[model samples]
Target chain A: MAKIQIIVICTNLIFLAFIARLIIKAKLREEYAIVWLLITVLLALFSFWRKGLDVVSKLFGVYEPANFVFTGFIFFILIYLLHLSIVNSKLQKSITKLTQELALLKEQLKETNKSKIN
Target chain B: MATQLLIIIPCFNEEDSIVSLLNELNQMVVPNTFIITVAVINDCSNDNTSVIAEKFSVVVINLPVNLGIGGAMQTGYKYAWENNFDVAVQMDGDGQHPPAELNKLLQCWHNTQANVVIGSRFLVNQGFQSSLLRRWGISYFHWLNKFFTGIHIYDSTSGFRLFDRKAIELAVQYYPDEYPEPESIVFFAKSGLSIHETPVIMKERQGGKSSIRHFYQLYYIIKVSIAMFFSFIRK
Candidate 1:
């Protein structure tokens, strides 16, 4: 019982640290942080429930400290992918804006040149 | 003397300016402008740019894939080399570059008989209300050019210029794909080509937002700087 309690507190503390770091980094959006926070919390709970995780980890041949570390890596990668998606969206928007502005300018330039011709 | 100049106007999605740019080019008082071919490299524009360009007597190079500014230029340079012209001028198809002032660079080319005559907006510390970042980039590369290749080119990144056959040969033979504009100056100087500049008036790009993205702006500066440094070290 004491071992379980200690593991639970340690996992919660580590997960809480991740949440604090993400907030400070301010890269991932709030909505993304919510989903990530939920996942971390769930994983923390799962790690606290040792017997279930032990069985799952044994099944995956990650029965040692591997479960917590692997879960942490996956959670970080998910957050990173979310950040990247947002960046890609911004690039797309800028490219669209530029192309549209170019089209409009070409029209005005055409009119200017035409008037000068007469 | 119009000097039978072959002006290479590189266009991507410039359907908007193609016709009028052609009109302006036709009216220019350049002597014997024989084949003033505006090589429009259709960067796979989904628009009607190619159809519009075809209406004019301009040479159109349709790339199966978009190779960007450098690729478009190489295609045009290849066309210029194949056709056999005395001089080739690179004017922007975006309507930013004035067609009339092409004469200034051409004149510089003829007068100085330099291998490469650039239409420089930065030569006299004039032209373009550039961003602070861009200004810094220009200054850094100008210094790098002097430091690396012992060639001092003022406007290291201007796409507007005239290149004779000798300059074209080197560029066509070996030009970097990603950031070719700045790096090309280094290559031109390294090849012992007399690089000269002419003061020409330029304006804000009238249409389409510039292709340089905010995030990639630093990437561009870094990539070119590395290439310049590495190319220097290679020497």
Candidate 2:
């Protein structure tokens, strides 16, 4: 194997270990950690089995395997960003609901206090 | 049960226009059979809008953060739903929605028994048309709504609307958070709710800049169209 491939494999393995530790420590939910774990595993595989990526890219009629990898990376980033946005939208809706409820409750409390003073 | 009406006015930095609008609303005559109240949603305005709104004896919901018109109006709907209001009406805080025509909207709502009643400017074109560019945009959405939802709404962008209890409930549960007016029409129609429009003349806004400006018009059109498309495709 080339020196660069050795370095890539070691880096991917370290990343996988770090994410595994995060999952075990309960710092990340398994549902989300699975995606990161899978990504790290794929990177390790690509580094060790460099010919595998080329073969797959050739089978898919991609002219350049590096282009395929970059495209795949961009596609995954887009999907991940979309997922984050969906989660954000749900959080925003809930926060708005909470704020509205709090305002109404405060008003009711003020009104009640006024009547008692009267 | 007697009808309980809640008028929801969403204000965003409308310190210049809110007081006069509130005064106009206070003087408007509502029917004796119905109980009426006003709720001003102060959408985290950086001005004295909330203080002025409170002076009018209206319920002021001071939002902790600014949630544009859609979020602000949804807060109003949630309030109406929780308070057991029978009907809810939305009017702009910029004094463009004439309080005198509010009675007309309620009449239409009562007569048609529709789930939602909108005060339309193009129904008879009573000489309060918007700018030429805005008119063209409104016309495009009018056609798009008719084609997609099969419901012809002359003024889909008009914020002056009265909602029945069912409509209020639905809106509280699910409402668009941005550019809600036109997209909401599609949502209501797709959900099998009846919508009726009545002729009402709109006045030019007295103060505050429009939320949808000239530069953002394209973005507004594209976003609303995509939202409407998704509403159609969703179950």
Candidate with maximal lDDT: 2
lDDT of 2 by residue, B98-169 (tens): 899998998998799999999999999895789999999999999999988998998999999999999998
lDDT of 1 by residue, A46-99 (tens): 766757666667676785756655886798888888988998867754553344
TM-scores, all candidates, are 0.64, 0.87
- The all-Cα superposition gives candidate 2 an RMSD in Å to the true structure of 2.9
Query: What is the number of backbone collisions in each predicted candidate, taken in the order shown?
Result: 3, 0
Clashing pairs in 2: none
Per-residue CA lDDT of model 1 for B102-133, tens digit only, reads: 87886787689999988888766555647878
Candidate 2 C-alpha lDDT tens digits along A13-85: 7888899899889999898998998898788888888799989899989989999999989999999999989
Worst 10 residues of 2 chain B by lDDT: B59-68
Model 1 residue B110 CA deviation (Å) reads 1.0
Go through the candidates in order and give each one's DockQ: 0.03, 0.51
Candidate 1 docks at the CAPRI level of incorrect
